[model samples]
Target: MSDASTPEERLAALDLAVPEVATPVASYVPAVRSGDHVFTSGQLPMRYGELLLTGKVGAQVGLEEAQRCAQQCALNAIAAVRSVIGDLTRVRRVVKVVVFVASTPDFTGQPQVANGASELFGQAFGDAGVHARSAVGVPVLPLDAPVEVELVVEVD
Candidate 1:
């Protein structure tokens, strides 16, 4: 089996640093592993208990900023994984991702915005980063945050 050190080294080589875990907004666990898969709870664009950005995507929040929020959500997901397994390198593959964009009524660029999280995973894990995904636009999110992301990872 590949060791955590290998992936950690790879992340360092790629100049990637996993951000600290975001605190849960309510009363749900961040991640739960069953057999070989880890299911992460929805992650918002929060830093230090505060939403990084508010309002709907494509309205008050620009696409670029929403994309950045997506990236932050990915970071938060990784932190949840680490909290459960003790090391991100133990993640064999990212199985799936669901990205939700709190969007304006006419916004239709959900997939493009979700690429922010997808790209970050690719940068951090290379081939293992690729995964099935769903990007959907909604009218609102918890705390009126711009974006939220959740992940399912296959680990050993």
Candidate 2:
């Protein structure tokens, strides 16, 4: 129940802000815009320069924690998007999202974990947040983070 109208205000209503774009841990840039679309590199659950959690889901990490990590990853992806577009309001649609969860081989809840990111997008962009998504389980991710997320967005 937020009266907030803009994306930044909506984030603030949740006690969050589009954080500073995370420093790339490797050679790749955070985001790139080509024509009307922006593609973001994979983003981990980093905060204040440290990962929120480091472990494989279902082994050392639980579902709830993994979901939280996923949310952070999406937030980082949002920051990456902002870096390129300079304005969240410019986003016309979130075209696609890919969530990667580092998990035990037995883990089959990748989709549930990805809901963390999807829900955040809904809160951030409302109807435009609806998008195709793929949730994949992996043995490991960069920096050993529990979750990573990337986005493809169409902008005005």
Candidate 3:
């Protein structure tokens, strides 16, 4: 993709489609904007309202699979951001990202898995997608998803 391309076009160049905003699982909304920032709730690797994979990484799942799951989580997060702002081009910066990896007792590669989301942001937003991030290993996540991610972005 070229610098002239928009984020949406960059996504298509990667053969990734930004799905419709997922239905909220509970009481909270997908995202909310405050001041110049928009915060998105945790996004599971769900497509068409169903989880793509459900298991604990390093146990029922493997590292590579978990990485793909993380990518999907980021894709979903992007969709959430668009659902609020109408266009991803409105984003001037991706300020922060948090990823939760459901893992067994021995998994120590949460950062690599989380890079799945981070790298995609870099691809879609270039320097703008560079951001602070946290990758945490957890006992479980909602709906037994292998990975979950959330983001905070600065919009135009």
lDDT per residue as tens, model 2, 1-156? 343487888888899888899999999999999999999999999998999999999999999999999899889999999999888989999999999999999999999999999999989998889999999999999989999999999999
Give the candidates in order of TM-score, highest first: 3, 2, 1
lDDT (tens digit, per residue) of candidate 1 on 11-105: 56757556677778799999999999999999998877788999998789999999989988988898889889997778889999999999998
- For model 3, the stretches where C-alpha displacement exceeds 4 angstroms are none
lDDT of 3 by residue, 1-156 (tens): 577889989889899888899888989999999989999999999988899899999988888899989999999999999998998989999999999999998999999999999999998999999999999999999989999999999998
Decoy 2 TM-score against native:
0.97
Candidate 2 clashes between residue pairs 3 or more apart in a chain or in different chains: none
Model 3: lDDT to the true structure = 0.93
C-alpha-based local distance difference test score of model 1: 0.87
Error of 1 at 10 (Å): 5.3
- lDDT-based ranking: 3, 2, 1
**Candidate that would win on TM-score:** 3
Off by over 4 Å in 2: 1-4
Candidate 2 global CA lDDT score: 0.93
Q: For each candidate, give its TM-score against the true structure.
A: 0.91, 0.97, 0.97
